[model samples]
Target chain A: MGDPGRDEPLAELADDLRRMVVETLCHAQAGHPGGSLSAAEILAALFFSVMRIDPRHPDWEARDRFILSKGHAAPVYYAALARRGFFPEEMLQTYDELDSLLQGHPDMRCPGVDMTSGSLGQGLSVGLGMALGLRLKAIDARVFVVLGDGELQEGQVWEAAMAAPKFGLDSLVAIIDDNQIQLMGDTATIMPVEPIAEKWLAFNWNVLEVDGHDPAAIVAACAAAQAVRGRPTVILAHTVKGKGVSFMENTHKWHSALVTEDLKEKALTELCVREVR
Target chain B: MVEMVAMRDAYGQALVDLGDRDARVVAVDADLASSSKMDLFAEAFPERFFQIGIAEANMTGIAAGLAVMGFIPFTSTFASFATCRAADQIRVSIAQPNLTVVIGGAYGGVLAGKTGKSHQAIEDMAIMRAMPNMTVLAPGDGVEVRKAVFAVADHDGPVYLRMSRDPSPVVFDDSCEFKIGRAVLVREGRDVTVITTGIMLGRAVEAAELLAARGISVHLLHVHTVKPLDVAAVAAAAEKTGLVVTAEEHNIIGGLGGAVAEALGEHRPTPMKRVGVADVYSESAPNDDLLQKYGLTAGHIAQAARSLMERRAAHAQP
Candidate 1:
């Protein structure tokens, strides 16, 4: 995993963190497990390896910004924020609960969240605006956006896609958590955004791709994206919905539902074993 | 008398002034700078202007994002697009979070004349008023429009500034100070009260003059800020004048007239008449012609006030 001294391997950390995702969902008794599980490594790479963010000072001016455009996958974001020390890890147990800091979707009131987002396809435009505003203020900070495959069907995403590179936001990086599944079914069947990389390329974005579940690949791909100049970058990550759990893998049933105590135990046991990517 | 001018022209000048005052204030347009009168702002600060090219939703979300970064963005376009087309985007991105994003609804109300009903936004005030954390405003003329623009910029949260494209008779002097939620008392009389908003203030003022000639005393209140409507001022007028006639260049429902009626209904319980477009779409005509056909002219307001006065007199006779 090319882990430098004084640390654990990236894949091991990502694989271990999958517990928090299911635990958050299980405690809440409702959430999107499919998308959250699929984007674990991607989020791990962003919060742990790639992004220059300080959890203690989540609102730090010089720190990087992260916007979860695909907000329904909030379980993963909440999990990552907790693990990264934005808040108490125990707070994950209160997710989706009334009066809890963790909301059903990503809300900026919670620490480490840049933009409050739930409605699809709007996050990219905001990221575009933030990038432009940052450039105007002479802030060299980077803005990272996480979008879902089905979320690409939103017209606002395309509107944002056209604008980012037009402004030449090389510091802006958009990672499409392309887990293949949408809310109802497969993304290709529902909307057909394939040749997605070419579409971004046509929009003049610097394009990259990686296995979304592979932590090291996710980190390396983001590094490559940041290296590009004079253009925004989009990393299309291929992943299976519900990647960790055996029966839930590539299935839409786990997109959102209760993770009963029985299923939670099985899922946690399955994710406990360290898997080399 | 104040110099007659268009609210749109005043808005452009206000932006230029605001550019000098607040560097955080940025303008985003959907490629209708000339119509929205944002060309002045663009000319003054080229680097600050963002031309989004007819994508209203994109403009709103972009502004919301900019607002998150401490820029007080003023997103401008026709009222129809600013309020209707990008409503969800505005609601989710700006309004819900209560960002310091100012929205300019240029060509607001039926004043978009000749461009027809599609461009007219009679329900803009209604739509914006419904959103939580949204400060909705409709300035009547050039002097007040400038004040309203500056007031909303200084305001803390999200605001929607409804601007008229039609040139109107200026009703306020340069010294007129604008407040966000307070009603400005333009004229005072004893018999009846004429409450109006947007371009209809000119007509209401004219109506007051006509009523005075006919031996009827007409009090006039110009309501520029619709949401956080100065209900206290409205209740005071309702208590004093007894008979109330509300006017606006918008639908009689859910706008200035509606807000006044609702306020008076709850507080003062005064007999009132609403003078505006009678719950219908506007047709293609000159601005004045449209105002005439929709019964939004001075004559219409005078007639409404007269009828209400006569009703009050008849009730008094008994």
Candidate 2:
């Protein structure tokens, strides 16, 4: 609602992101659909509007860096990267296959992935390192790390949290996809990280929150984070575990399950995508 | 007496020198800067030094990120924490991407002395050598430690540089050539071969002298690089002497002893005896007493060589 002119296209891109994730997971028959679907808008907003990157030169020295720390949601990351012209969209068909550039998790071998990440609680630390390196080189750039709420249980995440503020890394931003569910069950049932905003504020970070499915709000939040100085930022995005389809929404069953052909058709119909096959 | 310099001090000085030469070189320490001797580098380049509190896992992950951004990051901590505490971080962040990050593991082996089993890292070499794309280096003396620092900086992949806490002995000089994957033939003899790695080289050299006094010829090979081991050199030494002895200040299981045995087992089967800690945790003791108790002193090496020679002689008579 911030700007209808720009918001309309990003909303379209968000739908395209969700459709591609469903299609990619359908082809692989094995992926984490719940988290991938939940992150559609956040990925769409960053790849399309918030980030400064060149699709052709993914390794440009001065380009802004992005690391998918919750790397299990790799399908959505690949879709967004492909949609941004980092690679041909057709490569999505080879996701998770042997020798495929689209690995089950994000790998640096694939274009547009700044760092190879799959392990949880590692991305924020890596982002802090990148922020430090970029500052040392006098490069004007930012490092963005996307994390999962459930992944907050990892002690290393708090270790990084305690260190980033000490370094005064204003160029680093961490986005927590508060999708509520993990591989086991809801984060509240497994291990609660509730009071999430208070936790970040206590750790000396500039905290922000938004409806994760709202592309306009995500863009605004990212811009606000960029404007902050002297400290890192953490944006808590409230989202459903499975944001789009009917049966899969807010369920852990689709956290890392196979998407059947019929389920794929139903999901595509919900996202308003014309299924090719 | 041979000139003595602490391996940690040499490693620290090497970092300072590297920082002076390359602007991209940086150091990360996990709150053990003074103990690990990384404070020397921190003092030299304050802007490039990063003290990551006491979190080894976070420090390692941060180093990986620095490596990704084209900076050569050296992370230092005690061997026990560097390898075991941050193991998954090292494996996933650095080794998986084959990043050019050097891990400085200080007080490696039981030579952290008097600190007891918790501080010692007798299995560090085995742990690092097993990781894919990891280059493991256990320098024997001050000169080799310095050379290894510059070498791993220029190297394109991950490397773990194991160092000791105390000053023991200096076995090599600046003129001594040190290269990754190339074992140095410190001495050549005919009767028996005593292959040594890390600080054990000093005792190995002394052991050779003892054998010489007893009219026994000993061949000595000093292996500074453990992974991508010089298999050809090990095989040739075993082939010539027909008797081999591996001496190390670590558990004989999966240490240099195990590596040498595996190489010789495939290339040339020979009569062998491993001289090292006998796969048991050691208690707090003085350095000398611990070395003697674990059969890692020069005398123990000599005994192992003599026993191997006796076995060979007995076999020949039969």
Candidate 3:
């Protein structure tokens, strides 16, 4: 299982995801572009290569669970879910529209969404519950929860952090998208969650750091997490706020922005150029 | 004809029974294990029990996590801390997803004498009832509490069980059955109805006996589950008596009074009076004195019933 050569091709999947994010946000005309783009690679790797889930049976009892804790980045999760065949790819256009299953936030009512998680700092707790639930039932399924760097500011997250190791929830893994930018401004300026790895380690979690763009490294961290016992794992994936798009990258303004015709064209061109590589 | 038992002791005994039968049944407490009777569970199954040091929010969140993992978690803490401190977590984490997390709010209402207003949870029912997918129960006595413990454990989803601190007299016999969303008529009468819940039910029974001597027949309805309130029974009692009196050892603004009013207002609009603490913070006093001062005793309920009867009689005249 540790054979690095066995890893699937993630670049192609990331390219497809980049295209989906651009197309969905363009079609919907609304979404959090910066955060969604920043976390695209991590989402791609989890859905395509790591998580053990069946697209055909969304509620499979033994299937692994994934929670998008930073629900603002739902466009990325929706794109991955659609590509995995959880729903019709056409539903991507309905993002944030009234009565549409696809809202700005991830809703559990949607087929592949494990929990409703637009509210920050809550998805971790929900994921922890699912992990504990699996342990009690003697199920082998693991729980993977994605958290934004900004979401770590909430006190509830720390509260949950203290409990994970104490309960010996080794089946749980939290991946933080450390983009260094929040809604207000740079995360360091708004509320510094500096020394991210140290904080999780202090809380007794087995912390792993990786480059957000490197799918191989992300998969390796997940594997390392699975190898451990007793303590839960936290993979601190360092990322740029908006990775693919030149204009949006590292800009907090794009954390959530309208997709104008010009902006959409520029984003699509950048993604298309990357897919060609 | 219903026998009574304290809900707190029943909760402890039921937890021990659940732990014995199912390994997935885990008990988590915020340092009130002895008072809530969770000591029996802890001693019986050390591995399954967790003492989560005075952190109510963390306890609730952890229980939510345990439930999601397929563990049946019963979280015990003082009523005020359980409901007020961790309300947001309860609403979002547990109730929202409809997890099987049983919250035992021991020492509910004025029963926590000497501890005063800070410890007493007068608004727990109101706070929990507001959330969707939550089942709220306040058992009448020790026997009903035990039955309620077993019943809630068997049921799925989120449940808030409010229990008393002090030991109340056993009012229910072993033969008396308990079911969620059902009300039991402790004593039947037609002249007036006294609908009560929790420890206050005992006082309401006493009030009924006293009213019988005064030639005013009193009907006693013990409402165990407060949220899915036995509306039909309350409506039936109201239709028969044309007068209703609600009693509870909680704030008059919510709790039993609010539930009874909400039910009766929709179905049978009868002349009603509520016997509970009148929206004021309680001062430190002995448990009995506190109950009497807060208008939560038999005499207060009887007086409220009499007033409702008087109002009904006035309306009956041409």
> Which residue runs of candidate 2 sit more than 4 Å off their true CA positions?
A1-8, A273-277
DockQ of every predicted complex: 0.80, 0.82, 0.48
lDDT of 3 at A125: 72
In terms of docking quality, model 1 is medium
Candidate 1 per-residue C-alpha lDDT over A199-251 given as tens digits, one digit per residue, 9 for 90 to 100: 99999999998988888898899889878999999999998889888868998
Worst 10 residues of 1 chain B by lDDT: B1-10
Cα-lDDT of candidate 2: 0.91
Q: What is the lDDT of candidate 3?
A: 0.85
lDDT per residue for candidate 2 within A1-277, as digits (tens), equals 1222234477777778888999999999989999998998899888888888888788999999999999999999999988888888999999999999999989999999988889888989999999999999999999999999999999999999999999999999999999999998989999999889999999999999999998889999999988999999999999998887777898899899999899999998988842222
| Pairs with backbone N, CA or C atoms under 3 Å apart (clashes), candidate 2 | none
- What digit string (tens of lDDT, one per residue) describes model 2 on residues B148-174? 998987899999998889997898889
Q: What is the clash count for each candidate, in the order shown? A: 0, 0, 16
TM-score-superior candidate, 1 or 3: 1
Select the stronger candidate by DockQ from 1 and 2: 2
**Candidate order by decreasing TM-score:** 2, 1, 3
Of 2 and 3, the candidate ahead on TM-score is 2
Docking class of 3: acceptable
Candidate 1 lDDT over residue span B23-73, tens digit each: 998989899999999999999999999988878999899999899989989
Q: How many backbone clashes does candidate 1 have?
A: 0
